[model samples]
Target: MAQESSSVLARPFSALTLQQAWRKTNENPEITKADVALERSPRQEADIFVGNLIDERHGGPITIGYGRYARGQSLTEAMAVDDVMIVLEERLSVSTEAGTVSAGPGEIVYMPKGETVTIRSHEEGAFTAYVTYPPERPAHL
Candidate 1:
């Protein structure tokens, strides 16, 4: 049997305001890796870079992570929890089982639990987004 792919769920908020906030706080913003349970191969190039703002390990039920996708890179998966994503810079193309949508700077996108989605960045530049989702415990644990 083929293994199912892991997805990210997210709802986007205003990108402009968030970008401004990031600029103002860029000097020393707290960032960490997202704590989602997924398998990734070391040989695979890291197309997505994530910095966590809040997570379960930090004593929070909601997980908030900032992500940057390199140009031409795409991430596709089915989420295990509800998610929200806010575009911070450039543009991102989001595709779901229902349809595909394009979000630019300051736009927000929402993805429900168990929904399969694909996110990609344009070749002109990298795409940045803030993603948030409820903490989920892996079934194996």
Candidate 2:
């Protein structure tokens, strides 16, 4: 009594709803705060994260968007709002041709527009935060 991928309504991976994943991940004794912090990027558009230990190193002459994701289709295709995030004190970092910088506690850096950037972290702790962009207001305020 099982269903095939084609018959399924949604993707298996995508099936993990935010609430479900949070609960399951938290319950999984094998999973730890450190594990979450080290988890790879989800690569979901509209993703947002806060907190984590980020660090980056300089690379050959290449403009790098310290906190930006690679280009993709629509904003949804690329992380925009609440996707691909780093937990606070999670050892996150970004390396650019110009220089390297790391986010500090209570510090946030928006991904630069049109730039190659890499983000990573390696820390241990219960990473917790959320991300959401503001709605359109007005220009030239």
Question: Using Cα atoms with residue i matched to residue i, what is each candidate's TM-score against the true structure?
Answer: 0.68, 0.31
Candidate lDDT (C-alpha), each: 0.59, 0.31
Question: Pairing residues by index, what is the TM-score of model 2?
Answer: 0.31
Per-residue C-alpha lDDT of model 1 across residues 4-85, encoded as one tens digit per residue: 2223323455556775666654655454223332333122355666555566777787766666677787777676777677
Per-residue CA lDDT of candidate 2, range 20-48, in tens?
65566557775433443322233534223
The reply for model 2, stretches above 4 Å from the true place, is 1-87, 125-141
Best by lDDT: 1
For model 1, what is the alpha-carbon lDDT of residue 15?
A: 53
Considering every candidate listed, which one attains the maximal TM-score?
1
